[model samples]
Target: MTHRLPVRVYYEDTDMGGIVYYANYLKYIERSRSTLVGELGLDQKKMKDEDAIVFVVVRVEADYLRPARLDDELEIVTTHHAASPMRWVFDQDVMRGDELLFRAKVTAVCMTTEGKPVRLPAELRAKLT
Candidate 1:
């Protein structure tokens, strides 16, 4: 399944050239990933507090294909699958209408609050796959 989130660029998101700053694309996709987790019935805070498990980004590979300007309406599209017992991989895109502006592959792993790697909870693993 793919999750979609709508975002609007503001003055703060732009650079001196009036286009989005390159790093902001990562923020956009991160929000979409958070939203996806919520929509999937997973409560991150609960997981961390009750189960002592938290998710952390292990890697990100991104490509910028186009620029987004202030006031532009953009959509973030995200899809995910399990990479292993401890890791989940997400493929994401930043789009303006039908135009693809950016794409990324993000890898995340489940970890204990003390920073030790841990296997994903069975419930989350099932949801991700």
Candidate 2:
């Protein structure tokens, strides 16, 4: 399944050149992932409070194919690419209309509050699939 979230680039998201700062794409995809989980009915706060599990980004591989400027309305698309016992890999993309501006493979791991890696709960994995 793919989850899409809309984002409007603001002045703060731009660099001195008036193009979106590279780092802001990371923030955009991160927010999209959060919304994706919520739409999947995975309440992260409740998971942390009740089950002691929280998700953390472990790695990211991104490619910037095109630049987005201030006021550009973009769409962030997120989908599960793969999953292991301890991590889920997501393929996320930033698009403006039919143009692909950026893409990334983000790996996130579930961990205990103490910060040890943990297997994703079976129920949550099922929900993701």
Worst 10 residues of 1 by lDDT: 120-129
lDDT of 2 by residue, 1-129 (tens): 788999999999999999999999999999999998888788899999998989999999999999999899999988884477778889999999999999999999999999989998787777766
Clashing pairs in 1: none
**Per-prediction TM-score:** 0.96, 0.94
- Candidate 2: C-alpha RMSD after superposition: 1.1
Collision count for each candidate, in order: 0, 0
Native-to-model Cα distance after best TM-score fit, residue 56 in candidate 2, in Å = 0.9
lDDT of 1 by residue, 1-129 (tens): 799999999999999999999999999999999999999899999999999999999999999999999999999999899988988999999999999999999999999999999998898888766
What's model 2's lDDT at 70? 89
> Where does candidate 2 stray beyond 4 Å?
none
Q: List the residue pairs that clash in candidate 2.
A: none
